[model samples]
Target chain A: MDERMTDAVLATEELTVRFGGHVAVDRVTCRFRAGELTAIVGPNGAGKTTYFNLISGQIPATGGRVLLGGRDVTRLSVAARTRLGVGRAFQLTNLFPDLSVLENVRLVIQSRRGRDFDMWSMAAAHADLAEAAEAVLERVRMTDLAGRKVAALSHGDQRKLEVAMLIALDPKVYMFDEPTAGMSVDEAPVVLELIAALKAQTDRTILLVEHKMDVIARLADRIIVLHNGALAADGPPREVIASDVVQEAYMGKALEDV
Target chain B: MLKRILSGDMPQSRALGLILLAILIGLAFAPFLFPGTRSLDTAARICVFVALAASYDLLLGYAGIVSFAHTMFFGLGAYGVALASDGMGRSFGALAAGSLAGALAAAALALLVGLFSLRVRAIFFAMITLAVASAVAVLFSQLSGITGGEDGLNYRIPRALTAAARYAEEPFLGMRLTGKVLNYYLVFFGALILFLALLRVVNSPFGRVLQAIRENEFRAEAIGCRVVWHRTAATVISAVSAALAGSLYAIWLRYVGPDTVLSFEIMVDILLMVVIGGMGTMYGAAVGAALFVLAQNYLQALMGAAAEAAAGVPGLPLILDPDRWLLWLGALFILSVYFFPTGVVGRLRGR
Candidate 1:
């Protein structure tokens, strides 16, 4: 609703990704404004995750460029992009299985704080790092499980921990790939509430690839519907759900309430 | 007492501190209690290999990088000290300076090797290091004028570090202060300090990242950690520690050769030490090195006596004979692996 909030944007210009004869993601152009939560909804194998990967620099783009805060970042590495304030959570839980919850969050904080290469100092001796990690954990309501090993945590808790890690990195743009894929119906709302809480914060951009239409409808300001590796619909949630093309491609039963 | 000083927040840190303390006391009192040159010699060898194996653990256990080029760096260190002694004349200053140079050279070589090779996957990285290591060994063996070819270089060390020089005339604790005893202390204190330094390095914040990378490199990269640079640093530190051990070995034996220092056998020995002692646990490196060096040195004699006793027994002598010691060693290695999968430390920890 605010014109100033729309000034900062991340856009893809004619992006394409091809694997031999098949194209995983076709040429697509879109923009996600700052301080807004945009949902990318599509069926399985619809290139939603792949497109997220392309923008996050996890996979090389076959053509076109990714603009991060208006700077061309197609050639930047995954780590370089992360340093430039791009954070992502995987579809599968990619975490340090052997490390404790506190340690897992602390590692991300340590890297962001520029202490990853500190050879002479002890990790525990850094009071500020612990405080910062604990602060993020507190925000995610995971401080009680800080000392627990990540492998022992439930799947929902692990996802929450991942969100905690992203908060520790404090990125400008957050890319969440199926953050609640494995959570039960009861557990899913907890994650949704966390995401909603983040969405309420000003000047933060979120690109979420979620399969739950209810989640997309509740939190998304704009919805980008992808079908067969191409952009089929891009507009507000209500307008996109009403579109016949979206209804035929993906919004069959999921958009019944709308 | 020393355990309290070296203990940390890590799991098994107290155990590591105890092992280091035991090594300190055992080697310091070895010459007095055993009262022989052979015992002193064995103690020095154990100290050297302990340092070498622990250095290797920094890479294999912490960084999760398997390298076959370890002995090449060891050889470089030995050669650095041996060649320096030959040119500068044996003195404390010369030996110290030479060892420093040698360690630096080894670290530099590790940096270069790691930078180029660490970009590949784990298995390919191992193969490339193996290839490069073999080439370096060949180069050393061929360069007869400088490296002494296959015969290797034999040079004198400082008098205080030699087995011939006597530090005192009167006996202390029923042990004579011969060159051997004095040299034993030199190697003992030097190896102790080096091992502890490496321990400090592994317990530091940087070592935490190294272990994180070991657990998951992709996640580490995703969190903005530079995997290659971290691995390169670990490799360099490991190489430098190995070089220190190699320098001590060169001074102890008063010789450095391709077969003795740069051979694949030494690298395999280091690997066995890590595996048997427990990879990742620094204390395990010391335990593994001590057990292996002692076994390699005396197992044949023990088997020889057994075979001689069973000479009249038909099939018994064949398997237990000293001449078939390699078979016995192979069996022991397998038994260790099967029984102590986590290593000796792992077994002691009841895991």
Candidate 2:
């Protein structure tokens, strides 16, 4: 950890990835500070998820590096980065489908508790973890569904389970890639509300990748626009959302119909 | 008491408990109740196969890893005992030394194979293990000086385990108090301990992690579970268990042969046992092994009797011939699968 608390919690320096002559994230450098939500907005194929992957160690960078608290972590594996406090919620709701919701969350607690290698004791012996996991589920208003299998859960509940799992992990940085992508319109706000509650704590950094402009406006304190795999605009929500560069690059031929 | 014994993993179904209980009691007293060499041999084979199939389930059912190299580990234990006994003479010390060496070697080989292949996709792992296992089987056949080549080695066990060594001058309850009975007890108890140990493992916290990795590999990794590390550890454990089962077999038979342990057919048999018993349940191994081994030993004879009774029927004798026992075995498996899709244990528990 960096001694200077005022410093950026996470910073990427000219992070670039080229997939067979097609540059995905092109020389993008950005810094994210604590107590703020930075939303990365762009059109499809604009490298939003790709950038998240590099920062969370999902995919490696071809050029430059990712620094966590001024420490280089570009070569670390996904599990190593997760251990270093980089929590990631997938775009497609990646979770243990066969396990019950409580078990799913309990496993994360066990992993964090460093008891994943305890081969002698039964899983049910750790009653404290089950309680703690239920508390996390409580936060997401999913206590009723905790005993049910994740495979039987609706898309909305599955997304909520992902949040509960993330909470159990308690990582320093929260990286949510379109947390409500496939959720129904009625179910989207519940997850967005959970993200909002986390942001209100004002002690953790959250990086969100979303396409909904209204969502970006309401949740994002700082907005960075990506166009054609390059950073086109970076500023506070007010100025960046109105910038001519963003409108031209992202809005996609504004006023063609009008 | 049962909960503590099972490490909090209950059978979860009354029918499953009864079936498993029947299997446990049947094997425990085979010498006294059956009172025949053939029945005793059948019971001992059931025990050995139970342990072997349970070990395979640890990989296939819990860890969700497909490994063709399992029998290779089984062979290593058999050969370890056979060669050590050959050199050191027939003694319990030789058996113990061979068993330990074989288990260690199996663990080491599993670690190597897991490291090289577990990192890739599941299908690639299946392919790699298939290739490696075939290579080892062929090597056992070619290593004439050490492994006894294709004929394999028929070695000796301790004198106390042989039929000649009687425990007493008089027969006990119409049964001979011979060393063969003592040896059968050794095998039965050894298998019982192994099965219970596997039960303890599957209900443990580490076993839950294996189940997690099996259910969702990507999420397990994202959740800070070292997928490969956990998988490799499981592989090593499973391999060691299989080797121990092979040691029990060597002690009982006083023979170590490639076809007995290293052949691909044994690997397929193990797969069948795991599937028929239920992949994830340890008790399923016992059920699957007992069912398959009994069908193998007696199904043909039963078919022979049926063939004689049906001799007058057109084309019925040919179908019922003992030579076509495999055809009936295939039909039995298909019917079991159709009725008990999750294997017998899973079906019992699902209710």
Write one digit per residue (lDDT tens) for candidate 1, span A36-59: 899999899999999999998889
Q: Choose the strongest candidate by lDDT.
A: 2
Per residue, candidate 2 scores C-alpha lDDT tens digits across B1-351 of: 888888887888998888888888899878888898998999999999999999899999999999999899998888889988988899999999999999999999999999988999999999999998999999999998988899889888988998999998988877898999999999999988888888888888899999999999888888899889999999998999999999999999898888898999999999999998888888888899999999999999999999999999999999999999999999999999788888999999992
Tens digit of lDDT per residue, candidate 1, span B1-351? 354234353335467557656766887799987787777788889999999999999999989999999998898888888889888888877678879988999988899999998989999999988998999999999999988999998888877766567778888889888887777777888888877777777777788888889988888888888889999999999999889889989888889999989999999999999999998888889899988988888889999999989999999998897988888888999999999999988777766
Q: Clashes in model 2: which pairs?
A: none
Cα error of candidate 2 at position B156, Å? 1.7
Query: Candidate 2: which stretches are off by over 4 Å?
Result: A1-6, A184-189, A251-258
Candidate 1 colliding pairs: none
The local distance difference test score of model 1 is 0.86
Docking quality category of candidate 2 according to DockQ thresholds: medium
For model 1, how big is the CA root-mean-square deviation?
2.4
Each prediction's RMSD over C-alphas, in Å, is 2.4, 2.5
